[model samples]
Target chain A: MGRRILFITTDQQRFDALGCNGGTVARTPVIDSLARDGINYTRAHPQNVVCMPSRSTMVTGQHVATHGVWMNGVALPEDAPSIALTLRQAGYRTALVGKAHFEPLLDPFLRFAENRMGRDGTHSEMFTMPDGSVVPHRGFDHMEFAGHGAAGNLHYVGWLRSEHPEVMGKFVPNLDGDLEVTTEPGGDTMAPQVRTTNDVPRGWYHTEWVADRTIAWLDSMGQDDDWFCWMSFPDPHHPWDPPQSELHRVDWRDLDLPAGYIADHEEREKVLASKPAHWMGWYDGSFVSNYEAPLKWVPATLQPDQVREINAMVHVKNELIDEAVGRVLASLRARGWDDDVDIVFTTDHGEMQGDFGLLFKGPYHVDSLMRLPLIWRPAKSAGIAPATVTAPVGHVSLAATFASIAGLPRPDYTEAPALPVNDDDARERGFERVLTEWDSVLFGKEVGVRTIFRDNWTCSAMLPGTLHDGTEGELYDHANDPLQRVNRWDDPSVRSLRDDMLADMWDHLPSVVSPRRTCDAPV
Target chain B: MAYIRRDIHIARTPAEVWGFLGEPARLHEWFPISGCRVEGTKRWIDLPTGITFEEDIHLVDNHQRRFVYSIVNNMLIKDHFGILDVVDDGHGHSIVTYSTQCTPNVLALVTAGAAGQGLAKAKRILEGGN
Candidate 1:
């Protein structure tokens, strides 16, 4: 038997959401312990600050341009290189048991196989390929998918409909009749993505279901087999709805405003105006660049209490996710696979979460949307030191890292090197800069953005768009302005620095895909 | 006549983005249609919802990076003409525009929305790599 790999990911989580990451709100002891005894990444960023692109990068270790899933609606090609597939080929049992956003969630006619899995009422059982070959779905020998809510033809939805059918309506309807995300105001704050009194029991919540299903999959594997299980949790993302029984964990009235949030409307507007036009455009309802942002909910109308409420909901949801992680770890311990398992904990991307009075995320390149809380707890038998890695890293390096953990050769298609331990290790491995990009055409508006993070400074280069010419962009020095309240893109002192960063970013970017795929679903 | 225009700047050469626009058989690659069949200057597009549109290809100007077509047999459309143009943005990128003019402005809204999505997808395909 070899060291097992357990990859756990949360959706749309911020760097400051964990206790070890200086987050005072969410008491995430389970993950914080991983940081205490493992390698904690302080400057990890996603290649793309969205779900499908970031998740694709994680699985393939390829850039957005390389994988070609540039935006949400576009699906990652079925035959795209997958870390699970690579590990499976290396004789490891692989399974992904949670939110696999590799395919868009907006499939009405079940065009994509991911959405069609549970359409016939069989959930998570091995699916047969179109050619009648009983192959692994995207490299996972077994799979189960759970999204934010009961919206899609997912395994979790099927289970809920069969076993706990009455609680099905407890979830806010994720999509409307047009197959678009519903923007109905929910919860006491009247926030568009919030649902206050979701009466779903804690046991029936998708978070618990994901953990349970992961444990079941692990239990099914032989004790001597080397396994790679990606236990993804689809919570703390949107609809801000945790099980009502667990909402008592955090109180909105007791919570303070997030550090990135500017309470004063005028001051927030001032900060937003300093950045790119889309920041203010999305906040003031002048433009809608991405379908992720709720159409009916105006950021300008977001109240301070609503931010507090949303933060509280996210905190409660985080605690639930932490508990879920603890339960899964307990399962590993019970199976005696604890010390031989390497656990990597991270998220797809960060949420805006009332940063500068912004609720959701879009093309913004600030830390709120870019920085991720990444922790890698290698197997105790590996004899690696626990240290803080400050050098820049991107989610694109995960596949190679998994390959290294599995003692297999890195696939030729994987781009980045394996994960590094400390600043010196990272520097030695040439892990100096992390790149993030945003290119989306939404609501008849096109936005093109490329960002590079290096030397504690973040720089973004915006292409010509409806609001401004290509000259507009954002530059922030984390050493001084950690919250990124001000932009220095146009500053004379940082002109050379910004120009160099932009040059490096553009020069390093991979070529874009021709004849890009269409976004079938609003998600 | 109701007129609608939508343009997207793709990070590719004008000619590369124009390839999908100018070719009738490649219409399904970027547009909302599920399949496309061409018979000489006449083309038929099948939507994912099972509706088919019969159209006549007006022009395919390779030098100008422009494509023009019109619906000849459709009950709901009444009269429709569509034009797609890919122009060089001078920054090694191309600005692809899709415009449509048709009777009954309400129908143009649907065409405009679909064109907007198609243009966005076109930009992604033109700029994204496998």
Candidate 2:
């Protein structure tokens, strides 16, 4: 039989959230061990920083512009190319058990199949689109959907309501009475969307529920069957409400501020001022660029104590996710599949997590939102030595890698090649730069941002939009300013380098889909 | 009525910036409109989303570098007024201001966002990038 694949993904997690990635706050021994045993990618990024777009890139192995899921609230086309579908076509059992955000989660009329499946409890049934193509529900033979909170038509919400009705009140209500993401703030610091206490027991929380469902799905497969399973965790995203029982993992009062956060207000504003105009505009509440962040929440109003509390909650969530991963790996070991599974662990994108006093992510193209923690542990039986790759790679390379693991020919629809094993392999394979793009027209305010990460430099060019003209941009030398505290876009010293990078980026960008997709929902 | 007024400073002469804003036919050069047509004091503009607006030009004074227009037709708008001004800041720079007022209140936000983008694009073009 061919090697098995276990792809684990987390939502809105930082690159430094695990111990192997210099994260001292959360103990992620399970994921850290995976990095130690296999390849640890130091400079991996996503094609888009938001959930729907980045997740679309992961499944399709295509750039954001090509997939046309350029922002949240835009549903990926039903028949878009998918690696999961490719694996199933190769005679492998495939199942995606948690948090499949390939479709927008804000569907109210059940127009999208993902929400329809959740609403009708038909996750196991293969769905046929209006085009009469009967596919395995986005290429998965079985699927289960879970999101951040007790809102939407996610299967977790239905399961929670049906199986354990008592704990339904524990989670912070994600949607308000108007059926929008709730901006309610109730905690020690009154941070927006921050609920301090969630009384749901650890075992019944969505994190554990995801792992349990994945195990049950795995147990259903035959002993000799080759399979691909995606165990996606919806934690560490937002409304930081891990079960109250696990809050003791980290104390808010005892943690240090993130290295990216400038403690002094003026210093933070000065740093923000160096970048695009929207940075300070978002902080001071002068402009609302996107709907992903809480509208009523201003970054300038974020208190230091609130940053501590939020980080503590995120660390707690990370800890829970690690334990859940441990549980699933244990289940694999029990089935004697641990040694044969090519495991890939990563997140859709990184969170701001109090970086520069900002709490959520938007069009910001710095490392806080762009860099991802990616680790690929090849099957032990394959005997690939462990190494750290410092080259740039992106979500666009994931599908080809999956196809490689299955011993199948790379699909013609895939864009990038399989990921490199080490730095030398990356250099030999021409994996030199990674590109990320952002385009949003929320609240009638349009913003377009493009970034290129190459060598030790990061350059972002802002298109003509509400906040910035085409002339404004940011340039940060990662080797000197790892925290991206300064911008040298206009500096005469690096003008040549910045111009070259921007030229390369625009030349490399794929032609965007015309008559661009519309935003059906806010999220 | 809801109101919004935004200004941006460009390191260019007022006449230089007004060279692009003085003519009604060049509305799409900086604004988000895809195409526009002018017939004397009446004008029609098309947005990229295929929505068209019929406007009445109230004033166009090149000496003052000021232009004003109001949308006269559209069920979605109750009252819409827009003004663009480019004034010499007396230090070899020009300060361009764009203001909008609309009755639906939410529509003013839409116009305000477009005005912000339009003003930024004008600055970029006058200061030298395409």
Show the lowest summed lDDT stretch of 10 residues, model 1 chain A.
Answer: A121-130
At residue B18, candidate 2 shows an lDDT of 86
Candidate 2 Cα outliers beyond 4 Å, as residue runs: A124-133, A178-180, B1-130
Which predicted model would earn the best DockQ? 1
TM-score of chain B of each: 0.94, 0.96
**Per-residue accuracy of model 1 over A182-252 as CA lDDT, tens digit each:** 67777777877788778998999999999999999999999899999999999889878889998888889
TM per candidate comes to: 0.82, 0.80
Which structure among the candidates has the greatest TM-score?
1
- Tens-place lDDT per residue, model 1, B11-74, is 8887777776778788888777788899989999886646788999999889998889998877
True contacts kept of each: 0.00, 0.00
DockQ of 1: 0.06
Q: Report the error of model 1 at residue A243, Å.
A: 0.9
